[model samples]
Target: MSPSDQVLGTSVEAGGATGGDWVLHPDRALPAEPGVRALAREILSAVSDLPIVSMHGHVPVEWFVENGSFGNPAELLVVPDHYLVRMLVSQGATPAELGVPTRTGSGVTAEADPREIWRRFCAGWHLFRGTPTRFWMETELVDIFGVTQRPSAETADAIYDRIQAVVDSPDFRPRALLDTFGIEVVSTTDPAWSDLAQHHRLAAEGLGDRVLPTFRPDAVLTLTSPTWIADVARLGEAAGVDTGSYAGYLEALRLQRERFKAAGARATDHGLATTDTTPLSDAEATRLYADALAGRVTPEGSTAFAGHMMFQMAAMAAEDHLVMQIHPGVLRDHDPAIAAAYGPDKGYDIPLAIEFAHGLRPLLNAFGHHPGFRAIAFTIDEDTYSRELAPLAGVYPGLKLGAPWWFLDAPDAMRRYREAVTETAGFFNTTGFVDDTRAFCSIPARHDLARRIDAGYLARLVTEHRLDLDEAVDTATYLAYRGPLEAYAELAS
Candidate 1:
């Protein structure tokens, strides 16, 4: 018998949900109190099986186009996930020991073996307790892979072998799994200069209508980035527009945005260190662009240029009807040494305090009331949720509060977000949940968790007599399915 069969004393079929030894409680994330839990259960039953509308995430488009077999368990589950890598690294495990390749893609390290990495992850599985990562991991293993035994040093090999067998099956490929998971729509972030060959291929294969791209022009907007010049040149080449002057650069960005829209992109995403959006005069912007191109731009000049570019992007979004998404307040690469060795997204990005009221005034004032513009603002600074973002989104027809993201995507944080923002922004002023994950297998788990949390929050409203049960169920349905569809309507196939 195989290890899984030996462990379970029978062959565990994939997606059987027959792992009595490792079952997820039906009301795992519902309220603990019996009365509240009952209400939560009622609320959850209404929307539990609603089709998933994943508006924003980082899953590669090529995964669906290729439909290739996933490798061993560790490579699929642990290696590519920066969240797992960062946590293990914090607990004295090296990235190399977690099957993470070096910058040069070389695997000549101590943890090059997939089985060894799986063992290491199992050994440290306790580190994920009470974390969202743990919740998703459990769901993926037990519900998807049909593992009867919990992951630990004792059962590492058995679980790994079982997971590997499941992953290698035809049922585990991306397109089939997307259908299995009931994902109605998903978006992948792409750079402005991208040729979108993968997106084209997926479209040609008829899967492209469900998987869409999001335009992310951060590198082109940030004048101080090391690749800014090269990115600008590439943008010019791709758009067939000269970027030698500020006017030409703006035109190039406009062309790229049009191309992305033609390729089924509904939104443009921006990540800023701050929320500043001060616009510049044509003359000043032109001068700064010239200085930046000549490599003589100062720090202050770069910040001004970035802020102006944000305003410009807003104007372009207003014209093109693409939903604008701004994610700010992150100080990326908190530790330069680790960044130098491991490259970007090793999970060292830290949040900084941000004030959105004054910082975003210029952009909001210019487009907040525009008939065609819509914007969603996301921040790691929870203080801004009620104090700044909610109040702004409450009044501005153009602005909507993005769901709690990054460090604040946990259960408690999400509950707090509902309490803080719902009073002012109300239900419709928010964009519902955005998984924003890179882990493909965790997509369904993440969405399920969000739905449960929303149900619980709505149950409290029903108990408080603030909303009737029918209204609560309708609201839950909108949050789970309709909200994202309406918010990103332009991307709909």
Candidate 2:
């Protein structure tokens, strides 16, 4: 049996805090004031166990396809998490010390011992204080795995062995854990060229509704990427359309979208440094495509082409009925050396100050009212919450504000999110709490944190007489479940 199959007694009950556990407080993220805390507890209890509706995430599809057991605690929790790695790196812990694999030709070899890596992580637990990474890891260890002892230099081995026992059980396999966690539907991010055979296989096995793919065309859409030409060719091959011409390229993308839709894709995700969505004339776009293929497209021309394609993508969503997800304003891989050593997304991407008002005006103006179109705008730039995104989402029929994303998906940031956007966009105009995580085991913890934060926010509303207890509980349920269902309703159709 895989380690995850050993079902002990229920370890996740409220108010189960013991001397052994790190954080099992019933009112973990609730308001501190007595009356507010009581009210928040009642509100949180209403939605605490709602089936998770994970509409956007990066959990690997192969985990479901293979139904494989996770290898070890470190592989499951440590190596893959940039949130943990980045923190340790900041505190003088080398990536090699934590077992973060270096890219080939980077001249650095990561540590191979899981126990040694876990020991380092446990010893450095103090570094995670006041961070969401600690919260999630604590919950994963204590609640999910039934770990009781605190992780420290002395207790690391004991904790590791206890977790290893459960992880070796059949119950710990990825598919079993889905039911164990009560996840209703989870989406995996897939590139545009993907065949989605694994998704299809899941459908054949009668699990299609539980796992879905999200179409992501960023590689093929970014005209300036070094691999752009090769990515475009792959897209053409996948779609069975020649992408040698601009018209053919657009057709290929549309065909790929159709394939993705057939494979149960409900949404398309884009990552951009800016949300500029200006269009180019057909002739101009055609000329740019030819120049790009011929290796003559200038840097200036590439930027214009990227913006033009964003407009085109919106147009495609309007026609194809895929919910659009755009997260802008991150300078990806801020440290070139780290990026070179660790291929991208090793948590070096830094947030930039961005203006959504003017940058997104063109796209919103064009497709904001399209009957078949819906877009969710996510930002790491907190400045834009009330200043730009909330106001835009408040007025636009086709747009909704996404949950606090990446660096902002934390306890205090979550409270700040509600405080900033609730007055403008209101609760229903936001997309609810999406974990947006690659760490599969942390999904429940992430969602739990968001719910606790929301419950506190709603309790405040009740105290202020803006809402009654019943209304607050109802909204809590909506934010946890129905809101995501509504935001990505295309998933059902």
Q: Which candidate is the best by TM-score?
A: 2
Residues 1-493, candidate 2: write the lDDT tens digits: 1122236444344443344645567677789999999999999989988999999999999999999878988998998899999998999988888898899999999999999999999999989999999989988887777776778999999889978887887778889888888799999999989988999999999989889999999898777888999999999998899999999999999998998888888899999778889899999999999999998878888878888999999999998889999998989999989888978888899999988888788889999988888999999999999999899999999999999999999999999999999999999999898878878999999999999999999999999999999999999999999999899887322
Location of the lowest summed lDDT over 10 successive residues in candidate 2 = 1-10
The pairs that clash in candidate 1 are none
Candidate 2 lDDT: 0.88
Error of 2 at 127 (Å): 0.5
Clash total of candidate 2: 13
Best by lDDT: 2
